[model samples]
Target: MAGKGVFEEIIDGDVYKYYADGEWKKSASGKSVPIINPTTRKTQYKVQACTQEEVNKVMEAAKAAQKSWARTPLWKRAELLHKAAAILKDHRASIAECLVKEIAKPAKDAVTEVVRSGDLVSYTAEEGVRILGEGKFLVSDSFPGNERTKYCLSSKIPLGVVLAIPPFNYPVNLAVSKIAPALIAGNSLVLKPPTQGAVSALHMIYCFHLAGFPKGLISCVTGKGSEIGDFLTMHPGVNCISFTGGDTGIAISKKAGMIPLQMELGGKDACIVLEDADLDLTAANIVKGGFSYSGQRCTAVKVVLVMESVADALVDKVKAKVAKLTVGSPEEDCDITPVVTESSANFIEGLVMDAKEKGATFCQEYRREGNLIWPLLLDHVRPDMRIAWEEPFGPVLPVMRINSVEEGIHHCNASNFGLQGCVFTRDINKALMISDAMETGTVQINSAPARGPDHFPFQGLKDSGIGSQGITNSINMMTKIKSTVINLPSPSYTMG
Candidate 1:
């Protein structure tokens, strides 16, 4: 069992080397990137930032590991994944603490991320067997003459070395989500976690090492995306790239050339409230989806579209609920915490101020203390407003009034992003109608648009992203389908 002390050591700042070939090593260039604790706005540690040359070395190691990993028995790989999950379970508390210290994640949310990540590991281990590419018989049914003459075989083939890049918002969960499936699909992984959330990820790498994976099977490269992002993604060794970030995912996809790219990008998710919505329930759900984690999640509710008949009432409930949310240090168990960086805080503030200057009314007073911003609800916000379209990624919810459900759907669809959205109503028919019409990937009838179980298809439509992320989907994404056809001698029938 991994001890609490093991997890604590991850945050102590002494272990700053990048993990490669089952060992930690400093960058050959001897350069490092400073990691800041979001809660205090202070530099907590510096991690080795692998240079392009170091990336080349890591890719070579990963490529060599990929061949054997792909040949390993499925059950054997699954067993190791389950073992990693057990290690994570033992150090759950310590892992959550690291997240709080590293990214200023609210304690409860941080723990949930860690536990869910472990769940993802377990879920992938089990589901990988079921989803593993199996030989499928292909028959020539349409051509009766060739019925028994042709048959096709299909199998899921591993895509060699995978370069997985995770976002800052979900350092552990999303990072592990990528690693578990990549490994289960028999692909070696080279993970690049952003500096904002490197500690939790490095700790996760530690857990992976404890799981007894072979050397060169997994590596962690920490650094600024600009410095080594292209160097890693465009390398010839990487067969596929699984990325979750905003504009960076797009940039990588273009440079990745013909390689398979699975990306889950940004979102401007909205929550629509019809005239018949239950105000109390809707308000609570809205606050949870919008403000939790300081609105850092890709699926967080960035805008609210409500019917004019019930807009004012819902806004009141939202204001009351937002007012009660405590904004403090991550350790304080606040309902809200600091954004990842000062620039993020400033961006949110600037959006709110821009909305106000354009006549958007604030429902409650907002407080900006350094990197943290208390919840702010804006009323009378127009769809044309930047807040309505941009991904603020802060604790700000913009409420826009709509005349009808059609108008609401139209407004939601007009945005460049189509990640996730939800509609609140009791009418089953109406719910189905809105859900089908909405352009986002997933729609919630009476709930917020958030990623749920590890088995469900968690993906974004349109500009939100190109590929999906779930146990089954990720396995398919990480593996390639190969079909083989063998022509057999045609059977001859003798007349008796």
Candidate 2:
């Protein structure tokens, strides 16, 4: 697995790494899968895949090690995470290229994902140390004559284990948002990254190992999601499941049954451009949000709702912007890159075709090559259109026109997906009204909707997501409250 010229930089400790319980081991099934780069469709490397039985063994190891891991002082745990962050920074270049190769990310966006992930890990690590909890007495002898102090004060405490299922588009950032906090809060994790991005993710797992965490405390099992996903979700030992994707997140919710389930499903996010908004800025953000990461982000804007007063001008300008976008290999810094999988592109194109047949106007041809779905613009769309309500998760935007801001807000709320929505307007009253009225987890005004810093709570309303994620909320979500109380004796006993 190492010592080759191309892989010379990877150390023995970093390469051929395995799930550990203080020692490295092979998959019980002796089954392994070749990790592929979906962009170029090349096999990058191979990793061990756990059978259902092997999953149980890893879960057992996690359960056995949880208490010991939890007992370690909080500061030391924090320090280890900080070390992991340093290691990620040290390995950022190799990791970035790996992500671009696996997922076909433009070099710049690839760097963004890798670096942002390291920031998340480092942020969670520092936060874990500086924060803790204590119980307080409500009333005591220090209180006035007749009353006794007896309440409690506390902070977030870790759950035993969190199993994370990350998506193919964002191999590192999304998973780190879950894994970093779960670890910082002192919980063990078992990760199942998409088969395509497994190599970059495994390299990251090794970084955690190098950071000084003992084996099996933080582990991975890579294979088909169908093979081991059900086991991880339903396992008695998995106290929590953190998932990121579309229908898969919903499926996990079903299998989770009684376990605590946290999901970031999908969103039909919209960018509403009012007549009074700046044409240049609105057009810029529209293309940036809809096409960045090739439009694969859960937060990526999918629908553009424009007012008739400005629809024609806006459409012309936006089409001009879209036309300027270069669609080709990610290695060439193309404006739009290939979709993660061929099936995914096919799925999105079907939706676009449906919209076109239903009377939506097309501003450009929907291009497809191998697995890549090039940018496509659909205008004159109606809220009743399926493309308007469902997450395309591709480079297709269904543009609709409404009479007023109220109507725009109505259209935004019409979808079952409601992760995040953004409005472009200088009208403070209208902006305030939309931000307050829009039924979504986050509302952005004059900017594209996006996943921000690790400290802010990341979640959604309605079908978009359940529970929440972000540094603070994630710490709270991965932890449960346990009140500790102590009863004190009154100085004057009536019986005496």
Candidate 3:
């Protein structure tokens, strides 16, 4: 088991070093970036900010380590991954504590995130071992002119090195989601965790380190994306990329030519409520989905489209639920905590103001305490309002009333993002109809939009993402199928 030494070092405010060549090394640049606590607006700690030259060194090291790491048997890789998962589970409390301070995640949710990450790692390992390479016999006799003499065998092989960039909203879970699959699939990894949540991610990476992965197989580089983002993505050493962020993903896509890319951009997930829907179920899901983690998730319910006939009743129920949500610092385990940064709060506030000016009605007085913006629920939001289309990524939910189910589906499809959406209704046929009609990747029948308790085939249709992501899907993306064809001897016609 990994000791808590590294976690203690980070919590004690020691300047943390980036992990490269399988060891923690001080940045050659001698510069560092502060990790801010959103709740207190204080520097929780600082991590080394590597220079471009340092990034180059880490990439070269990873590239050099790839062949040996890839040559390791799948069973051996799975064993290490299982060990890392156990270590992560053992350190859940310490990592969750760091998560609470670094990103303002509620204590309970932070703990859950760590545990879930462990499960993800474990699942990836188990799945990796079970994945079998395919083989098939190809016969030439089907063409009627040629004899059968060919055999084809296909096997999964790793893409050299995967560059994983995780968003601040889910640093541990998303980072591990990328790391576990890439490693289990026989590829080396370079993790560029979000600057805001780097410390927590570093702690997770330390578990892999303690699991005895080969030198340089896994590396962590911490720096401003502006400084190293382009260089890292465009670097020749990176064979593939698995990224989770917003506009940064767009920028990376343009620069990451030829390299296989798996990205999860932000989304404006919508929840549609039909007249026949149960108001209690709809409202409860809305509050839980929209307000949890202060609505920092990419799948958070950004907009609600409800039938105008039932909108009033649904709004009343939602408002009552929102009012009961406790608001305070994450240390207090409140339902609403400060967002990741003040700029995020500013961006969210701007969207709220735009909706208000366009005739949206607020259920509560607008409040802002630094990064902590008390949860706000808005009703009567029109299509013209920026909040209807924009992703606030904060503790605000907007309701837009519509005349029919078609209108709700149209509103969801018109958005540039098609990550996920949901429709609430009692009619099973109606739910399935809307589910098929919605342009988003996944649609919920009567529940608020969510990622999962199970790793289903999660994806986005358009600007939401570039590819699918789940335990199995990610492993497939990280590896390529290689086929070997053999020319067999043909039987003599005269012998028979």
Candidate 4:
């Protein structure tokens, strides 16, 4: 497969280079990191492990390019973004294959991610043209005392350079979610793609290169975060940050100091089921939301809070659905694939053991082969068990029985992470009430917690994240409003 020259545009031999100043350059550090295939447990490719000095060079290039990129007309920027989107769509298959090999993402979903990223870029381009500024005329007669005339105009301006950090899951889609918005808003960007997902992201960056964005406007740095993370975030060259990850985001926020930050962090999304809910529909969503992508998603249903009256029935339906999921390699497009790494698999195993020791009942026999953990459904998951409150980030779904709507709301609100939550019921009034009380960024009345079919307002409350992210919100976050005021000379009154 390596000899086929599939990723030849972005990769040289077996190693991918870091992108800076419109060129793919080898690292001066003389070091590289292996990208392992989870299914085969083999190193499929390598990416540069750059030095802090290399990061400083990228920062300088981005800082130098910011004003020029921001000065470019908004229409031209949007046009280039559209072209990049087209390039991404044209190369979807190869990029998706890279995702499958790099991160164990199922083939079908990886294709969807690439296509969705293209659509997101296209949408951001369209929205960029519609970001309206404001003009207002003020009169002192509105106040009681003086006669004066004032006129004000306000417009959004780019916040210089934006540092984007995307997680391994949804690599293409999430990376574009940051890049396109930052570009459309007239800001230069420096992307730090996750180590496991860097190859696919670099391919995406290559699309932007084909689109003819100004040299140095978009750069990608690949390496261990511990080596260059602080230097990137703390550097004055970065004007704003848009990050999607876990605890790393918190650490970045502290080190990033006063620079603007838009983060989409960890989630412990809850699924609350009312007694009046449709058992069949509830069960289907639970399985799909909890186990899809092997439950690596931040918005994946982490816990199910069902009314005690209907807990037993819901568990039976959910278990039946889980039994039907196919488990195998991503090459075959199975429903559950091996997780990204062995340590992640070990962490999940620890959670399972903790639940078992504390009396949580597993519906199926526990099974694990290396990083491939079969789907697990735990019942009677008491609050005392770690599985009830902790996010497993694996194919483990815990069912916690609650007696009433109030009890469910209380438990959901008490959680530290609040990215999203869902409630299933036929009662519209009850659904509306729960939606209002839930402390999450989004509430699904009868559906599973998801990021989007459209880029609506997605965010988190407590530790989940900071700021809002959607098409417009993200653009707004990366730019700031600058207002110009003019005090008009007192008008000479002509007798009329």
Candidate 5:
């Protein structure tokens, strides 16, 4: 409340009275990290850097609240989600501001995120009713002389506590991706948002309380990833952990011990341009899909394989479009923005430099103003180059020329990441061929990878992630099935 916006509220038990639990307070650490504007590198506000113990308290409250919250009616639980969505929509302005300040995301992108966040909540609420179980049934019909046959229905139940770990990029939507489904499923949540972008999710939690949710039902702890992550994943009380970060996601999964897990790791997604494709349309879509979020999305296109005939033509068109994109402050409307961190900016610079040394020439040398790195293009990239194999997650696109569609498909599948990919071709057979050969979980034909409307089963194939998370998919990952049968002391079926 003291940092930026209005001091609103915090709630306790299924009510609207926000009781300040001291242990859940922001860090007492005097030193703070800068939350920068990627476009201008301007300091927004330095959030309180949380210690390990403070992060644990949120999960502790979750453990305390899980049993009682789980027993609440499914429909009633869903109502809280609906309420949260409504409140978030009403407070979109302030929340969007927080998002822009924290991560330097474009104003338009932030607004869309808030709306999509609400949609996620609504979707989860709808999916809640569908979790209903079937009635009991037995084998009485099969045996004419049998007097008894009963089998209890198999329906979903809460997985106690859910520790949701969201990334810095798209902080609001990614966090809600976990929160919505978990809350709708009647499970208490302990949200550990990125330390760099903690305010957005904090504002979201405040909105949740406004929607009449019990205080302990949803909680937050802002802190360093390594410390909070270790605590959350290894905690005995947490039944499952939902993670969305690159290396951090993997770390959480490994430390989950025996707990159920859901992960959405970053990717070096690819896009293929074929001979018969329209180069102009392909260029526009490529720019928007790849660098829309500074290439920070896990599904962002980092690799492009073009057919020999159209490689030069398509590259020129994409270069012209990339050059025209306006790079400015996230507060202002702009086609592109700066990379998220100074470290990230530096890394991209090094990657480009290294590639250039290895004969991969950039059409334009990357320009860096503080943390914001403008879009840079490089052609004649080989698979052996580090930039070709690794994920830049920045505004850098590297093109690799391939002779045939078959070779392009082979190169795309060679990477460890299997999150997303795209192909553009007039021939249905070629599209189908790449679709079958690509190792990724989600592949688009003439379209970029996306997770919109909150309905698809979004997951990865290999190292990208282990489990999936969406409206209904998130529910299924955290739950297991058990059979119940009542056969009137069924001695007839037993060999004994």
Candidate 6:
């Protein structure tokens, strides 16, 4: 692995302290957590784990900051966000390098993610000024001749504090997706970056500060979520939460009382192939969607549901494509890289072995080295197998045969997760029918189920998530509607 070269360059002497009240400081309890570089499997940095006292201080600062940030003219806030986007663009290379070192994201994918985050920042900035609530004219006919009218107005107002918890997979993009919207919508933020990917997040926040955002308007508190997540969520000062992770979302909803939550949780997405589908194209997309970023994306296609008529042929095509994928350092040009941790590799390997024990045959050789598990394609994977239902979060794909499109849809909907799914066919009617019938948040007819543009609605269903998250939708999610009505008196009228 190319050691942390540019990663060390960016964070040279950068403070890893807990940021609050527009300043960085150590934890009141003097506690810290070691940040590991997944690629090198070495401890590269230490971030302070905020204690309860620091959590309170950060929330208090957020509450205070929200009052003024919310009062700032919407256009001014939008301008600041645009400035932040430009600053991020200037540091794009460094941020991408940090992602590769911090979370083991591939170099190309990391750079793309940085660009995506910048787009999100710019999108939210433009949306904040354009998507304002409009006024409505109301007429009352309570007494026929005695008429009265009222002018009503509605607009989105900031919710005081938003606690944004972003996952490790997309350290820069996901965190910025949340932070940019919250700030543009005039809400103060307390971002809790994934401990494993804090360095990239710190670099991102510093850009926001340099962009001239108001002090205390945004804070990034580094700590174990189990410790400070609940404390901050349950705090009286915090008004909303935007979390992107696993089952922790349910707990956050329960513990946070009645605050609004925008969460995008785990996904067990599926890629369904029909008999008439293009096998080579499907294979190519499956390999791209499944093995990219080592399958760490929430929308990664973990299972391939193929009709029995084309199962064998499709598996062969996929096997051929898998052979060409390179498994090595993320800094190199490779199809796969080391996953976030050794445990993820073990879990994925266990699932593959379990399928093998249960009569599933591997279409390709299973190669493992340290945290990198080369792409594995399991054919004849039964629905009862864990690999068929679980989110592997690694470079593995389970292929299951189905008799009909209905059977494939049934299998796809049977899981507790319903984040996203894809179907392949040339017939538009069948595509629409399958898309309408699939029990997921988003359905792709010919494309992989994955995150798209920053302006599109991105979310999940079932246990996958609570609310939508994109530029416009997220700004709406971070704000509350305030309605006002003004009564107007008319000249006296004779009864009809």
Task: Report the number of the highest-lDDT candidate.
Answer: 4
Native-referenced Cα lDDT, model 1: 0.86
Q: What is the C-alpha lDDT profile of model 4 across 439-466, one tens digit per residue?
A: 9999998999999864799999999999
The best-first sequence of candidates by TM-score reads: 4, 3, 1, 6, 2, 5
Find the 10 residues in a row with the least total lDDT in model 6: 1-10
Clash list (residue pairs), candidate 5: 10-18, 11-18, 12-215, 14-214
For model 6, the stretches where C-alpha displacement exceeds 4 angstroms are 1-15, 133-146, 491-496
Name the TM-score of candidate 4.
Answer: 0.97
- Global lDDT scores for all candidate models: 0.86, 0.78, 0.88, 0.89, 0.76, 0.83
Best of the candidates, TM-score: 4
Clash pairs (backbone) in predicted model 4: none
Writing each residue's lDDT as its tens digit, candidate 1 over 44-137 gives 7688777888888889999999899999999999999999998987777877877888889988888888889999999999999878835587
Please give, for residues 1-496, the per-residue lDDT of candidate 3 as tens digits.
1125555433323677789998788887878899898999988878888899998888888888988988898889999999999999989988888899899999999899999999999999998888733334455556776766665677889999899999998899999989998998889999999999898898999889889999999999998778997888999999999998998788889888898989889899989898899999999999988999999998999999999999999999999999999999998999999999989999999999898787889999999999989999998899899999999999999999999999999999999999999888999999999999999989988887877753688888789989999988999999998878777687323255
Lowest lDDT 10-residue stretch of candidate 5: 11-20
Q: Superposing all C-alpha atoms, what RMSD in Å does each candidate have to the true structure?
A: 2.3, 3.6, 2.3, 1.9, 4.5, 3.1
Sorted by lDDT (best first), the order is 4, 3, 1, 6, 2, 5
- Which sections of candidate 3 miss by over 4 Å? 1-13, 132-146, 491-496
Q: On a 0 to 1 TM-score scale, where does candidate 3 land against the true structure?
A: 0.96
Residue lDDT tens for model 5, 131-200: 6333334455466775544444456677788888888897889888888888777788887778666767
Alpha carbon RMSD to native, model 2: 3.6
- TM-score versus the correct structure, for each prediction: 0.96, 0.92, 0.96, 0.97, 0.90, 0.94
- Write one digit per residue (lDDT tens) for candidate 2, span 1-496: 2223333433233333345564445666666776655566666566666688877878888877777888888888888888888887777777777777777888788777777888888888777666553433344445567455444454567889999888878878778888987887879988888776777787777678778886678877766566887777888899988888777777778777777777888888888888899988988888888988789889998898999999999889889998999988777878788877777878898898888789888898767777777788898898667888888888888888889888888888878888999999889898888899999999889888888876887888888889988887777788787666555554433375
